[model samples]
Target: MIVVLSAVLLFGANIAQAEEPLYVSVGQTTGNLYGLYTTSNEMWAVATQRCKDLGWKNLVFIKSADVTSEVYDLMYEAVGTAYYWSPIIGMNDLDNEGRWLWNDGTPVSGYTNWGPSQPDNHRKEDCAALEWPFNTWNDIDCGREQPFICFQEPSEYKRSQIDDRLFSIRKFDVEKGTQEMARSGCKKDGFRLAVVDSDAVIAKIEKSINWNSKVGYWVDGTHNCLNADNCEGSTSYVCEDVFPLVLSNSREDYTVGNTIEIECAGSGVSTVNVKWQRQDGVPTDNIWNEPLQKIEPGKATLIIKSATLEDSAKYKCSAANDIFSPSRGYVTSINITVHPEAIKDAMSP
Candidate 1:
């Protein structure tokens, strides 16, 4: 009883049993409850499993920015001035040093709060923890035992799958996440990661989804920046190994001198560029390609203007990106024909 009193004084609040939701507040979801429980000298691995079996006690690996702030406060109240685990959840460069990732193998979204001179990789330390004196991150060895926190994951923001050219991980749980989970998430929806390359495509994606500004959106720019770094200046999140698929068809017919249009199906919701070529290998130059999209029902439109007899040919449209190599580019064959004016008039009746 005396020892418990001292610990509560140290924490500035009475320490409760780990199973109790002492600080339950409105979280991203209904069932989520945040708590920092003392393990009385349990190692990371032991604590992880014990917590899971006890309940939904996955080690709290926070990713949401807004949630992080609220959690910092909750953590302060829970631990007062003590170090606790953060799960600094992300991919670790097992092949290389100084690289990290989210649990799903997607790069950590954005805004990492590494403690000063932290991630020093000291003694091969890989996992992260919120160090005391301030809940900044530090890459620490995973074997050490200490009281750890199990907090709620990122909030489930609404996502929209647009035009099979771009995809976002919808309803992802921080617990038991993998890159395949994020990638295959798009796969299940018949899409892939929306690769960011140009300002136009970037702009289109921004317009397509109502991404929570409070949280960082995962936009990989390995080729868009094309400077070796996934990002322009400091590399943040890099693209994953997800390739888009074709979900729609691109075949159309029209009268001579009339506008003919065809839309290449997207591998999934993502961004893509389509180039048209004649059956005889002549690139069609009279076509205007632009992204016509909306969130209600995500779609990208491609248009061929003022079809003429010369436009009668089998055209090919392929979507390509560097995320997946060997250029197994998704191909769409469009057969465009200008109905003879006589035939058009005859068919009009």
Candidate 2:
């Protein structure tokens, strides 16, 4: 009887565990391994140590928009189409107020995808995270608990080859100038209008300008220099590139007996094989055998009709082609929780 009780306990524990894949290999290109932990949420400090305990270097450091886009896509694939507070990043302004810095001691500036008037420092929020759907940066309270993403980098790992752009600031004799005048002024000093490209340049520009003067400067770019455009009427303008620097940057519920559908799509390649899985904590046995219907050439849908409480588990969708393996595929997921009571009430109505 005692042996039988042990066996039953083991089986029950397995049933309680999440059945979806939580970690996907990003491959060796970045010289890093990435993992997303969603089984439980943790605060900022606890989560930081959690990554270290798991042999990760730190929380995923977002050094560029490309990195942001890639991680965002990964989150979308792994968590499905519901709103998530998301994987806590390694950015904070703990030492200095308004002086945000990455965990690696890099200042936060330039090419920021901040939600409208974000990082307002609401309630002394020092930590930073990427909000879902919009994929914008937000300052979060470090004490808040949330799922986190971790990256493991080797000791010999180096920064990416794409360098950050830098610039020198030139304050005009008279504050507030026209676009052409700003350009001419910069050209006079053997420089063109300041092309604000990276965070380093933005820091320099902010430091050189007089915030109290309320003067405008001419900057060459829009959307924080993601594209080329001339911004007029600024106190000071920036010169050409001086050097290279580096910098970085929710859920839905379901009722029981309802049909659940999730769409998985892949781009950048012409064709892809999409697969769905339930996180089982094992390398194998997670491959979901549910038949997927190809909604489009590179897209597929996972549908479960008349869902039950047994379907309440994290589900992941992966898309891959010949160029990429399932481990390095475009993946997304949706955590579904079915409510038996809600379903029953709806059925009664």
Candidate 3:
């Protein structure tokens, strides 16, 4: 009887074996790794929490318009064997009434995959799902359970995408801030203040700024100087043969009070001149700079604060004298975007 019971127990254990999880690599260059989950058709809310518990940042959501095709294929492969209720994205009208927000804290702009007049918010349906047809987004009830797509670190792919566009030679305007401040801000977000040496680039930059109705960007060019034309005889200098100073405008992200820093990417930190400037083409009276906070040689940190909407803008870090000769300075910048959730708390005095 004991031998027979042991055999039955072993057989039951085999029957309960779990299926192997499937893995997919996204963003050919960005290399975003994801795991497809199909253990059960758990509630959208429950699956979201489970994905986080399973060691992922959040659901496999779309960040850019160009990613729709890649995401569609991944979802099709994931649901091949099981016809479960797994959603590929984490989006809902949970916080506000009509607007759907992404789990990654970004706007869901550009590409969409709504199933023909769907997302009617039927029965107060808030959660998004990729149902039987696959490749389409459906606004379903959050209580409904489904398998989901969970992804690893997303900032890597986001950063890589921005890095690839760095040399595009367009007028990469930031929201606001002076040249030095913009330079520092851009480095934090994986971009540099653009270096425009051609009239075509200047025209493109000017058009973008005017169309957006925002202040102009501080490029690596003398103010008032446009395309071999003394033009306005700008006071700014542009050195051609100066040792290039690398500035890091990483990922352009921060909470209130976060220390925003920009450092020299290479040599000449000891004698380099670094300053923070804003977008209005002015260096004085900016909000981030402290009158008494002794500026260091290699890097400068600004404690971001402010409750108003106008607080978000571009900042540039200008390195001159040593590498920037006779006023010719190569500059870089980053845009400082404010977090909607953190804004109120950050602005609290």
lDDT of 1: 0.44
* Least well predicted 10-residue stretch by lDDT in candidate 1: 1-10
Taking all chains together, the TM-score of candidate 1 against the true structure is 0.34
Q: Count the clashes in each prediction.
A: 20, 26, 54
Q: Name the candidate, 2 or 3, with the larger lDDT value.
A: 2
**Per-residue lDDT over 43-81 for candidate 1, one digit per residue giving the tens place of the 0 to 100 score:** 556656654654433666566654554454454333333
lDDT, candidates in the order shown: 0.44, 0.55, 0.47
Ordering by TM-score: 2, 3, 1
True-structure lDDT of candidate 3: 0.47
lDDT top scorer: 2
lDDT of 2 at 82: 51
TM-score against truth, every candidate: 0.34, 0.42, 0.37
In model 2, where do residues sit more than 4 Å from their true spots?
A: 1-21, 25-32, 153-349
User: Candidate 1: where is the Cα deviation over 4 Å?
Assistant: 1-32, 81-96, 153-349
